[model samples]
Target chain A: MIRITTPLTDDVIKSLKAGDSVLLTGYVYTARDAAHKRLVELIKAGKELPFDIKGQIIYYVGPTPAKEGQPIGSAGPTTSYRMDPYTPALLDKGLKGMIGKGKRSGEVIESIKKNCAVYFAAIGGAAALTAKCVKESTLIAYEDLGAEAIRRLYVEDLPLVVVIDSEGNNYYEIGQREYLSSLK
Target chain B: MREIHVNEIINAVRDLCIEANYYLNEDIKNAFLKSRDEESFKLAKDIMDILIKNAEIAKNENMPMCQDTGMTVVFLEVGQDVHIVGGNLNDAINEGVRRGYIEGYLRKSVVKDPIDRENTKDNTPAVIWTNIIPGDKLKITVVPKGFGSENMSQIKMLKPADGVEGVKDFVLKVVKEAGPNPCPPIIVGVGIGGTFELSAYLAKKALLRPIDKRNENPFYAKLEEELLNLINGLGIGPQGFGGRTTALAVNIETFATHIAGLPVAVNISCHATRHAEKVL
Candidate 1:
């Protein structure tokens, strides 16, 4: 497993390939469907984002509440496709990495290839195991948004897989097709 | 009939909201473990390992299993004799949802509209269904609906003559079309019979059953077994990255329907099928 401590850089993104297992540790941000919408709007209005995206990984998650002394609640990757629209724009701005499950669409794949970025999928439904990697947690912004609020997390060896690499390869699709073909 | 205050119901619902999100019920946990034993693909098995690990971490640390904390879907069985002392029964349920999602640290995924989509700050106005059964105790089932599997769900109104073969084709088609998107190894919940709406409900409810268990009807039980074999044969495996456990299980729930129609609904649930219920 490749261990990466964030803020993710071009080197980190370039190093990953589809199918490579990853353990991302360090500070990263969380966003889901609602926040993704807000982010695109921010890009459209040409306003400053709350955090620097350049070479940073944004995890598609809105976890359960953290109790006293806990770093973060069950933080796992959500489906990545929902953020596809905002991805190209963010990639253009030097964003290099994402963490979530599921496959990317044609447009997102194209953008990923063009911009040279990687998409990692966290294990779906394995919130408990994933939470063990979180070392610390803090609210970055959007507190009123509740779980949708953008929270920063300090993680250690958080497990993931490169679902979409910089070269436009998507393991989820390939994996599925391969399995389907084998059936015949 | 036994009587309980409305506030008690609200508190029960509120607690269920947090409990349902914070923990993975034992039935789901055991299903995955059993699937691991039965899974054929290395990649699929590994992915399932990740899922099992994720669940363990979530439970230990109080983290939600999935980020799509889900739209609040509550199923209520209210006793006819019970009296609600709270402001309103519906309001109590909504209030509980609001507090549970907010305080529990789960996402509020409800949107105001599907089209000109605007989020309703709190995940409120739950999709609640109440059945007035002859009982004094309130029974509530909470399903935190995730979009990955929910998006793949389908309903078909087939001609009665189309029969079992037609159902098989459609079920396979849904899984085939869904491929890796629904986050395999998947669970296909088949609600056969009933009307269009009830079929859909049965499909979702069917998912609550243990992943390794079979339908009670011997005929349908055989169908479930066959369907499981067919789905797993797809090799969509765990998280669609390939493996033998394309689908961990196939659950079928049926009800008597009109003579003219055979409504079949498939509610596909990902490996992380999270659901819980509490009776008070």
Candidate 2:
């Protein structure tokens, strides 16, 4: 069981490989479909984003509302490919990691190779257990979007599977192909 | 004739919404469980373990099964003998969805318009389908459809001549095209016949059934069996990692349709497959 700290560097990021399970600890952020659109828009305009892009990891999640005595609600990875278009830009800005489910695209794969970034996926829909990883969370921007808001979360040992590595390998696509061909 | 107050209906919808989001239907849960034992690939089995753990955590922790929380989709059956008092039946259902999403801490996933895309704050204005029946009880099925699985769902308009072989081809095509996108090891809900819309409805409805169970119609049941065999044969195991278990089950729901066309809708569900129903 390998555990690593969050907001990882390009060197730390490059060391990881596809299919390795890592428990992510330290600062993490959440974003989903809506935020992706806005982030992309900002990237297109060459404007600054709310948080520093350097060595940051964005969790692809929009958790349920917190109940009594809870820090955050059920939190899990949303599909990753939805943000594929914006990923290369983020990677270029020193973003080292992303957490989501499913496969990524060619451009994003190339970006990972160039930028030494990696992608991880928490079990999709395992929201509550996911919330346990978030030790501290606060809204940094876009609060009006409700769950879609950009928030900084301090996490401790958040579990994830390395789906895409800095070397430009993606588990989802490769795994699916291997699985499909094996049957026939 | 039974006259039900509007408040009662709203309350029923509200309760149903919470129940649906919090709990995974027994059948869907069973499907994931069964897959754990049967999956041949080591990685697929491990992924299944994560899914099962996710479900247990969601339930015991009183969390929404997925963070997407899904767009609210309710298939409502209203009896002809029942007359709603005070307000519109549709209003009651929407309000119930709003209340449930807000009160239950479920995420608000509905968008007002597709192009403009404004958030509906509370997963309101559920995608509701109503059918009038000859009874007093009103059935509300709350289906929270996550984006991943919903995106992978399909509608097939095959020629009437193609028949079951066509369905087999179409279903496999969909699964193949979907790849890892639907979260894999999906439950395939196939609806045959009816019009385009009705067939799609049947497909969504088919997903509510138990995973391994066959359709009551023996002919369709055989299709389910054959399709199940074919889908698993694809080797798109859990999380689309290599495995013997591609689909947990293939459920087929057929309806009477136009003579010239054969429409099939595939409502693909990820391992999460969250749905719950309440008849009141």
Candidate 3:
């Protein structure tokens, strides 16, 4: 598995390919449907975003509340499609990586290629296991959104698979098709 | 008539929510182990191992197995001959959900309004279904339903003439279209017959059954086996990475319906299929 650190650069993203397993470390931010909508709205209104999007990764997750002495609760990826409408805008802002599960839209894939970004998927239901990889968590913005609030996480060796690369290759299609053909 | 205090119901539901979220059911755990053994795809086997390990950590550490601790669904069977003293029924259930979520550190996922979209803060107003039964005991089964799989669930109203073939085709189509989105290695709950709404209800209810069990009807049981095979053939293995165990189980539950309409619903559940039951 390839190990990639956060605050990803174009060189780092362009080197990856779809279907490559990855261990992501460094800083990643959390956002789901609610926070994405607000972020897009801020961009439209010419208001400053809560955090910088340039050279950063946003995980589509709404984690359970952390227990006392724990950094975060069972934190894992949510489905990515719900954030599709707002993704291209964020990608345009120099966002370099996304972490979530499921397929992205054709439009989002095009934006990924155009902006030299990558998409990675953490195991969807492996929340407890994923939480073990998170080293620290801090709430960033949109506190009223509760679980949907933006939280910054410092992670170490969080297991992920490159689902879509900057070159526009897609793993969901490639992985399933190849595996099915091999069986035949 | 036996007097069962509302607090008993409240406490039971509270414990059910906490227990269900923290502990992966034994049937599901065994199903994963069996799938791991039978799985030919190396990647799928690895994914299964991660899930099995996740369950162990959750139980041992008292953490939610998945981050989406889900909206609480209470399938309540209240005894007709018993008296519920001190409080109303629905409030007690919501109170239980509130306490359970707060105490257990489960995520409060429910929003107050669909359009306005504000978090209710305490995951109250659970999706409750109550039935009056003959006995003097209250049976509550709490299923913590995460929306990742719930969003992929589908329902169809087929013409009566379509028959079994139509049902079979629709079921396959839903699972196929869902592909990886519902997190494959899913539990498919099929509800056939009844009205459109009732069909959906039966589909969710079917998920409560253990994966190893099948419909009592021999014909339905055969259909379940057949569907399971076809789903596995789709190559949408664990986490949609591809493998032999696309689905852990296909559970079907049926009720009589209108002569003109054959309603069917498929409720897809992720591998973290969690539910706990208690009798008070």
Poorest lDDT segment (10 consecutive residues) of candidate 2 chain B = B233-242
Which CAPRI quality tier does the interface of model 2 achieve?
Answer: medium
Per-residue lDDT of candidate 2, residues B1-280 (tens digit): 8888889878877887777777777777777788888876667878788778877877887777777778888888889888889999889989988888888888888889999888889888888888899998787787888878999888979999998889889999999888777777788888989999989989999887767578998988888888888887776677766686777788899989888999989888876666777777
Which stretches in model 3 have alpha-carbon errors above 4 Å?
Answer: none
lDDT of 3 by residue, B213-236 (tens): 999999999999999999988888
The C-alpha lDDT values of all candidates are: 0.80, 0.82, 0.92
Docking class of 1: medium
TM-score of each: 0.88, 0.95, 0.99
TM-score, ranked from best to worst: 3, 2, 1
Pick the winner on DockQ between candidates 2 and 3. Answer: 3
Which digits, one per residue and each the tens of the lDDT, describe model 2 over residues A93-118? 88888888877889988988898888
Which is superior by TM-score, 1 or 3?
3
Tens digits of per-residue lDDT for model 1 on B141-248?
888887778888899999999999999999999998777667777778999999989999999889878776788789999999999888877767777777777787
Error of 1 at B44 (Å): 2.7
Worst 10 residues of 2 chain A by lDDT: A175-184
Better of 1 and 3 by lDDT: 3
At residue A128, candidate 1 shows an lDDT of: 65
